[model samples]
Target: MIGNGTAVEINARKGIFFEVFLVFLKLGLTSFGGPVAHLGYFRSEIVEKRKWLSESNYADIVALCQFLPGPASSQVGIAIGMSRGEWRGALAAWTAFTLPSARALYLFAQAMAAASGGSSGGWLHGLKVAAVAVVALAILGMARTLTPDRIRASVAAMAMVAAFVLPSAWGQIGGIVLGALFGMTFLKGDMPSAAAALPLAISRRVGAVLLFTFFALLLGLPLIAAMLKSRDLALFDTFYRVGALVFGGGHVVLPLLKAEVVPHFVSENDFLTGYGAAEAVPGPLFTFAAYIGSAVGGWKAAVVCTVAIFLSSFLIVLSALPFWNDLRNHPSARAALNGANAAVVGLLLAAFYDPVWSAGITNRTDFALRIAASLLLFCWKTPPWLVVMLCGVAGQVFM
Candidate 1:
């Protein structure tokens, strides 16, 4: 409510809601870098500069969101908004965080229809590369904070490997489940840090009922649609399954999407092109469902698909986030989280190899370009958006 010099005062009830909507609107518009970069922006703007939450508290919220199933950065934004304002704030946060990228993606999908594959491919490649680096940096940065000791480090390492070797979702689920179990069964009653522990306002019973109701609706909505044999079922099914199943983040859903959409009617080449285009646009990867729906099912399908996917994503995020909060606060849960974190690393590594590295880094020039781009991102600190732009030009000229 209070900022330096300019004091914009409103009733606390309305003020928080407006602030959430406005802040998220700005974030949605300007938030350019992938998830990690988005995190950086949030930390700098909201945490450090705005003093909305302490760095530790902000990070705790982020950790909780990361372990959830939807877009991590967006969820973090929502959590911040909610923490500051309440459910209305949470609504504002999600809308602001998601709307910009979603709109941009809609434009990108339209552009792809007119442009040739060769012309737009490079920038898309660059964006993917940049995305990969951003995710890696995020994992590393998060690890530095989350894993301070050998035990935690070991947990992270194990999680990473498990992600690579088994399914990626395994690591994510493992982290949350293990973190919770460890906390409940083993970790003793150690209070959460002051910033991280807001006093529980809702009754425990009420909270449990609400959480259960939210998830029940989440699971039931799509099933209900399916039973009715809705025309939008495929789109809903795909989006719901993607929302329900995939772990790590939006990028990880590419493979699953490929498996489902490609064989049905969407061309492999077209799918990849759309995917690359999706990477270039802003918002959650799940929004790609919009493009897919538009292509296969028309505008109505696109609408249905977008709603289904977003709802599925929103529900999963809601269901999983509180549990993640509990895990981080509890000691024993922290132990299992250690392993799960490592598994996330491993899964990311695998993603780098399969889709990002293997698929993108094909030729010698492509390989060389990747190295140069990585250097630019990691060393010289060129902006990722610029890197993506340059890479696109490079892709047009060369690849």
Candidate 2:
């Protein structure tokens, strides 16, 4: 590793583990505005300023992570860390970049739980309202980007309708699968040439083994947990499955989580409050998992849930790294991704309407506040965290 006053250059063998850790640690503390904003921070600090990787390299990693399940920004950080210091770098990068928000959310959940006692408060309602605006904004922006063409838009709409009909986790998964099939059947079209292939340290053989482990855990954990009747294992399985299946990003993960946790492990009010509170935090929105974990079973659950949620990103990213180029070049695979992306929008739409809109907007006052927050998000282009904070305060004052 060497630094030219302007930038830091890291290679495979140098002692850059700590440097990489610190850079991402700073980002974890300061990188707000959700995943897209997180990506911008990574590009500015790691790419343009630090010179750790090229623009194309970052873009390629972003593309691959977006295709895979889990948090794309965190995975991008892990991938860049891998390039710098192999597994050690990846571990360091993920820890530093993820830990800050995770810890903050865990503490916040604990604080809210302690303060609220047995009764819900106006602030909780405020947070729920914040979720209303944030998710609405997310759906609109994602639809514009992911479901741009008519076919994909239709896929999104149908997926939303199906989710409404089923109203469960199975519905969300089914929607994604159907969208993929639809895209493969109808959306295949022109393709851009593939980006330069990433140079990976993991061999094809190791990738295969890790890939097998990923599937084995995915398929077997549920059975193992069921046979043993262990709630801990069951919790882990729920989060792991969610991490593996979620397609669009963090916002889409909300509905899947609602299906899994609400009315069982966590209450409806707690869930929405956490969802709204998550919008106010920095780093990847996925740290919202930490809040859920803490709510159910304290710090232990917090650690376990956090690991379960993110473990797939490590296994799948490394496992798929060796084979990504071949897959990326195939038109069929790309078309399926297009369909899945559209379905992701639908899933968000479904989630927004039910748990988000329905729970948050109970009265005329709540509805008016949500509209104002949405306008702040859309027309004024206010930062999300600020909008969320203002909503919380408004919920306290007005309703």
TM-score of each: 0.73, 0.94
Candidate 1 TM-score to native:
0.73
- Measured with C-alpha atoms, the lDDT of residue 87 in candidate 1 is 69
- Taking the candidates one at a time, how many backbone clashes does each contain? 15, 0
Off by over 4 Å in 2: 1-14
TM-score of 2: 0.94
Q: Write the per-residue lDDT of candidate 2 for residues 1-399, one digit (tens) a residue.
A: 236532534443345888888998999999988888989999999889988887888888888898888888888999999988888889999999989989999998889878854137776787788888888888888988899999999999989988988888899899999999999999984474557767468899999998999999999999999899977788899889888888867798998888888787888878888888889888878788899899888999999888998888889988989988888888898999999999999989888888888899999989888889889998999989999889878877877
lDDT, each prediction? 0.61, 0.86
Candidate 1, residue 13: lDDT: 61
Best by TM-score: 2
